[model samples]
Target: MTGILRLLTARRGAGRLHWTDWATYAYLGLAVLLMFGPVLWLVLSSFKTPAALLEFPPSFLPMTQKEVRVEGYPQPLPLFSVTMEDGSTRELAQVRRVGLIAQMVDPKAPGTTVRVAADKRQPVREMAFAVSNYTEPLAKYDFLRFLENSLFVTLIATAITLVINSMAAYALSIYEFKGKTLAMLAVIGTLMIPITIVLVPVYLVVTEMGLVNSLWAVILPGAATPTGVFLLRQYMLTIPRDLIEAARMDKASEWRIYARIVMPLSAPALAVLTIFSIMWRWNDFLWPLAVLTKSEVQTLQIGLNAFQGELQTQWHYLLAMTVVTLTPVAIVFAFLQRFIATGIANTGMK
Candidate 1:
């Protein structure tokens, strides 16, 4: 209890910035909720029933049809008086409506399985749950195929990015040569050019290279990222020149020095780049869409769009799939968070 209190007090202390700090923290919290509240609501709605989902007074925890069915036992069923076609009132024994089923179920049997009669006149509208809404999307669309393709592209691209970025950064930071200034300028210059500006030319090149509809279309283009190279170069510059000199004195080859010394010393920076590369490649949508034309080759983000068609969108299954998709990124972030923090601390200044 004291530990909890201490933690709360610490949080409160951190939140306070004189008198203005409280207001700043309050504003930040509100801004965060404003951005994420809708997303939270969408995720919550996935668990709700169809009727409750579209209900006016939004249900917090909508009841399911399964709740009504207890094996060989029935609760005192509520009397919903329905007017018959003959204009006479009749109590429904078990009409099997949405969010409702009439059955004599056993409540006392602890482990007994309950059975509900089907193949009768089942009402389709006003379903008690979002089961169909969720399952249909996975079955109807090639969602799993898309997930596999997305993983393939992201893993390959991340691997390529790591190799290319590390080598280029080593060259720029450690090796002095002609056009080095021009090379740095060129890399930095790309920051000014929006990717959209080169889309047409890039498309033409990819099409000519016969790489369209292949994972290479996504992987190859993403490998030479200027941001990755630039970030790595700055970190590499922090490596002490003495280490390289010592390595040379030992008669070590350049490759040996880089492999044994530079690589070992660059752990924190590599961790930072690994996290960034994973997120960028995993959640990437636009370029993958432009390059890959085959339905089988589409990534998760594009596959998500395919789930949203002209007429209908399955919010429930889509939200569930999103949760599944985001799990990996969350896991990676949680594991590598310390390394990322260290990288930020060392950026440029170190």
Candidate 2:
């Protein structure tokens, strides 16, 4: 917390700001606005009504027309600020509208109705949040099941990816053998292949294994990523060779050396890889969509399709669920982000 405060209050070298400081602060301010402005808009819009969302001039605040109940009125009437002929404004409840004129009534005097031009009246609105945008969907859809499926796929797949990639990296970095360079090149080579190119073949293979509509179909195929292997391997190369030799002289097994020494020392790199793996598995859409067809097993990304339809889409609900879906990834990144710079910088060392 003190570190955060220091960063937030940082200035130019314990003295008055220089021109460069002004430029740097301006650039940083713009960058922050560009990054977080849309996210702020999305969170606010998720609380807006359908009509307010469709308005031509979008409002930053969630606003709804104020309504009031008057004596002898069967329903609540929308309140409006009406301009009278004397050029004074009065707060009146709108009873009905005909042509360009609105019949306005004073809530205190229900017997008299005053007709005012629609153009002369503005809606009396207040900041209101439509909580139903979030509530209705949870009540109507099987979000809990979708959440479970997504959590299962993301967690299991990430664990498998880390284990497999770290093992491959350990072998590649620690042992020298025939075709080692070629194997490393081939692993790195897979990064060039666009995911779209392999979707069909991967789907066919998954079908052959009879894992369609299964969470394993999503988890197993992406268990070993070349990127993870390359990152971990490069970082592992920086580990001193003497550490392994000393472990061997101590009668420790290869697995013990890998687990006890290599793994613990490679903490930063592992954290970076873990973050990548979680994001990849959690946000994966097309592959999960192709594999999990059954509603019972569908992940959150696929389940978001429920809000989209042939005729109309529920943007409010979609936006709300999207915020919900982003929460876990944000939390994970927040916790693990400190390792990114350390891991990436050291990976370049021979």
Candidate 3:
């Protein structure tokens, strides 16, 4: 009992943190803000009107100008309060047909209206929500078509990627072959070569294959990636050889073992690869831009390019479409993120 009390007291003495720990926490807080601040701004800005978006000294929260329609006004006029030369204030009533003259009313008197120049009117603006920014783009632009194309390409490409990469990783990890080392080296070698260096050749091949202007041109070329194979192979190596030998002792076919044993055990790795593949295929711009020339078949990223005119950009629509583009990837990450954490932790330990 005396020894236990001494050990507890020592732990209590060491539990108190110094200034460095607090400083580290503060730094991490700032880093997190810096990372997510723009994303928060993008989401908020998607709900703002064009006029509100262009306001000087930009607002982080979405807002719109306040307006009211009076008895004789044909359109809604901006609401304002007028302060007269006599230091009396009146609520906005209406504007005159002539010059910048605005009519004002008194809250105390129901039937009272007064005339004031536009200079004397202090405009009032209130927080306004603009949901049309999201809806209008989908209605005016063929955003639905672009969204469909993006989904089709992302899903198909990711599925193919998982199948092909997993098979390759399985072969390299489990099966003994004469040239297995060379094959693994070849896969790793491709990673050192930048995609930009092969862009022209890839485009030409797609052109010769008659895949240009088609979604297949985008999907086929990226169906298999070296990084996916490497990731899955490394994770698969951590699985014990005893399991595979035991399955073989049971007379399980190689394909059966791969499908039933390997796949289920590698769920964490597959989840990680699924997220990576989805992000790549969904956000891919250059390859899709090079191959898909038809407006009807263009991906969301390419379709978003249409908003940028030579002189002016439709920022409201651009921001809204950007939010739309990011939604699916965000959702996929949300669901599969735990798997990713588990996979990385296990892989690192291995």
Candidate 3's C-alpha runs over 4 A off are: 1-28, 93-120, 348-350
In Å, residue 123's CA in model 3 sits off its true spot by 2.0
Cα lDDT, all candidates: 0.72, 0.92, 0.87
> Model 1: which ten-residue window has the lowest total lDDT?
118-127
- For model 3, where is the 10-residue window of minimal lDDT? 4-13
| Candidate number achieving the greatest lDDT relative to the actual structure | 2
Q: What is the lDDT of candidate 2?
A: 0.92
Clashes of each: 8, 0, 0
Candidate 1 residues lying further than 4 Å off, grouped into runs, are 1-6, 9-40, 60-136
- Give the per-residue lDDT digits (tens) of candidate 1, residues 217-311: 88887788888888888888888998898989989999998788887888888888888898998898889989887898888888777657789
Clashes, model 3: 0
Task: For residues 1-350, write the lDDT of model 2, one tens digit per residue.
Answer: 99977766677778887777788878988999999999899999999998889987999888988999999999999999988999999999999999999999999898999989999999999999999988887778888788888899889988899899999999999999999999999999999999999999999999999999999999998899999999999999999999899999999999999999999999999999999998998899999989888999998998899999999999989988898888899899999999999998988733
lDDT (C-alpha) at residue 132 in model 2: 94
Q: Write candidate 3's Cα lDDT for 231-330 as tens digits.
A: 8898899999999999999999999999999999999999999999999999999999989889999999999999999999999999999999999999
lDDT of 2 at 174: 98
Clashing pairs in 1: 17-21, 71-105, 71-106, 72-105, 72-106, 73-105, 73-106, 73-107
| Residue ranges of candidate 2 with Cα displaced over 4 Å | 13-15
